[model samples]
Target chain A: MDTTSTHGASPGAARAALLVLADGRFPAGGHAHSGGAEAAVKAGRIREATDLAAFCRGRLHTSGLTSAALAAAAAAGADPLALDEAADARTPSPALRATARKLGRQLMRAARAAWPCDALDALAAARPRGAHQPVVLGVTARAAGLGPEDAAHCVAYESVGGPATAVVRLLGLDPFEATAVLARLAPELDQVARRAAEAGRRALTEGPGTLPAASAPLLDITAQAHAAWPVRLFAS
Target chain B: MHLDHSHDTTTAVSADAARPDGTRRALRIGLGGPVGSGKTATVAALCRALRDTFSIAVVTNDIYTREDAEFLLRNAVLPPERIQAVETGACPHTAIRDDISANLEAVEDLEDAVGPLDLILVESGGDNLTATFSKGLVDAQVFVIDVAGGDDIPRKGGPGVTTADLLVVNKTDLAPYVGSDLGRMARDAQDQRGELPVAFTSLTSGEGVKPVADWVRARLAAWSA
Candidate 1:
């Protein structure tokens, strides 16, 4: 598990390592979040597979693209602190920011243990609370011998995967249907990942401001509302 | 087979009880079992019995609410600052076993809030027999099942029944009233977990939590050794 390589290895080797990093069961605390699906379900905006697909598609281009770019930038060896600030700026909702940091801290814990990198050590010390999550994910992907494209793919998949799984729990929708929704969106996910990775590569020269600032106003508002709820299944 | 009780707060995913500076951290013990099986009661009892001798904190994983954590706080089992609740998003088992990131965060938060504590008891929300804590989250575990749930629970041995570090058959006073067979339960537990200790407790009784508390003391002693 020599994770120090910046350029990583062959495509086949990269895929195998990516599988481990992108696994849904990576123990990164993504399970407890609905990524706005819970609020959507409660608001009657998302009821079945069709609504779920639309919701995921909307998220993919908006906050999902933003997160993917941040991750890809980190994987591309961008400064995590600057990327973290970029994350905070892109995330308007204070509640979402808190959720990002909390999940960031949790992911950092798992990544530090799994990869044991010095770069993770410095970030953990600097942000004892946590940096933004996608930054950590990108940095973790880098430490795991993955590249910007790999990190982008991981973020893109997570963006929709979390909401789809959460809908299954929230609506009791068929597990097969939920999985099919993800499968249906796979092509779009790939496109988003590629664009995100490209943007990340450009950010190295153009600056962090060159990154996408796509926002979903509804999601930001709903996430804030969801945080105040006294009783809810998912955290956000 | 002496365990490395050292918990590195920085790189820990599971039960790393040593802070990065080499000083020993708290011994984390998990209590898990079926819904309504007195897991919360046993945790409260353990806190009551051990708080005098050990500086302690508690982390509770609740399915939908912080009821378990609130119970401890209401009872003053430990101070409010010493208690933390992890919302499990309706999956207690996932938080404790499959992906323990939230629980790890809660435990570490408790340690950070409180001082260099001697013990931290992590109580799982009432879950089925199949639920158990991951080794990454707790130093040791106690599977708590009430005799009232069924004496057959031990006989129908699942992972928690067969392999927990300690199996606590709680609410023994209700055994006769509920028509549960205590002797048979004891025998079945013995068969399921050979050489591992089992404690039968009625927390209402004065000395009921002593045996489990003694076991915890021994574990703490060994951890500090």
Candidate 2:
């Protein structure tokens, strides 16, 4: 029952910390971004809950899986700088890469305040511009005493959750329907998290190059187009 | 694993007094009000008035576009590099109050790009009466409302009107044309804010931003002291 001994507790006891990190309102600057939902919505690809579901499903399996794997690897103690490079390689659009790093720097700021670990500080100092959000998320999980699975789950959930929330705003879709979309995706989300965590575990020994490289070409192309728009609701 | 020591990064966390390099950071002042309330105009005027006296920069939170930042740049109040624009995803209040990460990054980037700044004005996008800047984001806040918006806005007080460090009633020149009673607004504002100060301005006239500029100068004096 000693409060000072809490750090020594098992990851099972750190469920609250995981929730804190994974919460949509973590103040890590994710609110300003639509996770490509804006671009898809503008292109008439996400007009309703069904389209949103399909879009999120596609994203979750491709870029989402890749990001989850990168996060998991970082959480499993893979080199963050290398993971950052891998994230850059996976992202074809320069615009998405900038968004990822911007979000990463913001996440680093919040994580340093929330956890205050040397590892997070080192990453922040090393990449003053930013180090890719998935990498930062993994390192943040490690700092918060969570494991690779927890980090992967966070990335996997965020992959769809961000778009679903954004579509509700852009299309004014039913909030309940949006919630249901995420509810339906929960099973796939778990699978993605498990696969990502497995890859992350392998990455701990094989290096960050071993992480998954799922890609969504349409998202990359549309992101570049979205960035050039003179007026848009989301940053990326 | 909790590390006891402070972070070694150069980025200052929120309103930290000193930069990590052991130099004093600039004092941040936030400006918030409803749309068309002259928040950007006041920011531009403040920069013009104070730029000669002190190193200054601006961080503008625009709801969707870079209009505010562009306005400042077009006026040439401060150099292009001294201005930064942050997108708020249609929630200016959230960027200024709830989730201030983007705005914080803007301020930190400004300081890094142009350091030794004496002041940085954080301007919130035109929002509702309830919007207010977080204490962590700025040392003080100014809530601006135009006489044209309605003199009754003072009586219909919200967080911005009641708790802001300073309340500015702008566009006094339009009061007669709009049929807004300046005296009533002044009295109601006094009632809403017991001892807090208020400034009435008409930026169309020469030296109209003087009152707000004086208030900022006083705040800077106290911050430097």
Candidate 3:
């Protein structure tokens, strides 16, 4: 549970690297995904800002927490291959798994170019098709010299940020409102990231199974349905 | 050329002339334009014209549907496996210009699947004049605008019209019916592009794609050289 150990060797430049990795426009193939927002919007689960906020909150606590912990574990120097398997075990839907791998492969390409590291290369060779995206993201953070907390924060933010951005496109919800939804979730994001980082620290000694495995069944169910849509805006 | 010091890694970076295996990658050319400006038609026509001479693959960034990839597939200009479609979320420009990771993946995957390719055509979903491919994504780009879209488009001179390696004024056959001034369009394009080339074509007419195909051949030649 000692999270500070992960940050001991991180340079001050790691902070800027975190910003670069967490930027919405980081070019890691996230734009095409809706984080289940599309399925929720189409099913009438999310109509306006309030519904969107609720959907994001639900996602944040479940899949977001799980993914953040996996990422944090990877960033804290957990075996990426093992963390990838743990991610697959936590993700129930095959469609989501495929999406994660596809995005992971894309991110691997970008990460290798941006920050060349042997760990990233080893994981890439092991899972050329891709490891899960959170696993890849954690390794990417490490390659960029970031800490486990930074990795956790990136995944936590992306969990809500991806859908909020997509909702602006799907429902034509006011961009300001969508952004404000994210702003409102910031404190919760911090808590989740902190918890995820703590779990990641524990996993270094306890094994990857110690990481969070929160599940949002609805998201898993809707993602499969979303993948089958012949005509949809987002890939996931 | 951008150099990578980590040359031992297997990952492919954007616009690298050589592949990870030390072979030359395909010459990637991007086509971008506004909605219904015949970008897909140009791609299909180019595939038909150049497939005999070169190993060609197409990557279509469809904004919503896979219509562009389907069009090429339906036309049978190239085999189905040679074409890859990328969903652009909602913003076609962002996929092409702002963030090109997906497109680059599609391009690299195509090369891996059907490689030793000579040319790879990346067609952007129809977008506004501001849309253009990033330099990191394509070696060159062709911006297609038609006579029907309005003769004034060239005069407007956005990044696509002004800065693309080539400007294609499509649908010349419709000029008479649409009451567009081809001469003025050409002049405006020349004025905007300086010494850069512009091709006028009507895919409905015989050998309409020849001029564009010839331009592509010259580019391919330069690339090979």
lDDT (10s digit) by residue, model 1, range B12-67: 54666666555677899999999898888888988998899999988888877678
Task: Kindly list the per-residue Cα lDDT of model 3 for residues B62-101, writing each as its tens digit.
Answer: 9876888888899899999999999888888988888798
Give the CAPRI class of candidate 3. medium
Interface RMSD of each: 5.5, 5.0, 4.7
Report DockQ per prediction, comma-separated.
0.43, 0.48, 0.49
Global lDDT of each model? Answer: 0.88, 0.90, 0.90
RMSD vs true structure, all candidates: 3.8, 3.3, 3.2
Better of 1 and 3 by DockQ: 3
Q: Across residues A1-236, which tens digit of lDDT does each residue of candidate 1 receive?
A: 23355445532246777888789999889999999999999999999999999999999999999999999998888889999999999999999999999999999888887777777877787787889999999888888778889999999999999999999998999999999999999999999999999999899788889999999999999999999887778888
- Cα RMSD of predicted structure 2: 3.3
TM-score of the first chain alone, every candidate: 0.95, 0.96, 0.95
Share of native interface contacts recovered by each model? 0.56, 0.59, 0.62
Which stretch of 10 consecutive residues in model 2 chain A shows the poorest summed lDDT?
Answer: A1-10
lDDT agreement of model 2 with the native:
0.90
Accuracy of chain B in candidate 3 (TM-score)? 0.95
1 versus 2: better DockQ goes to = 2
Q: Report the lDDT of model 2 for residue A30.
A: 92
* DockQ of predicted candidate 3: 0.49
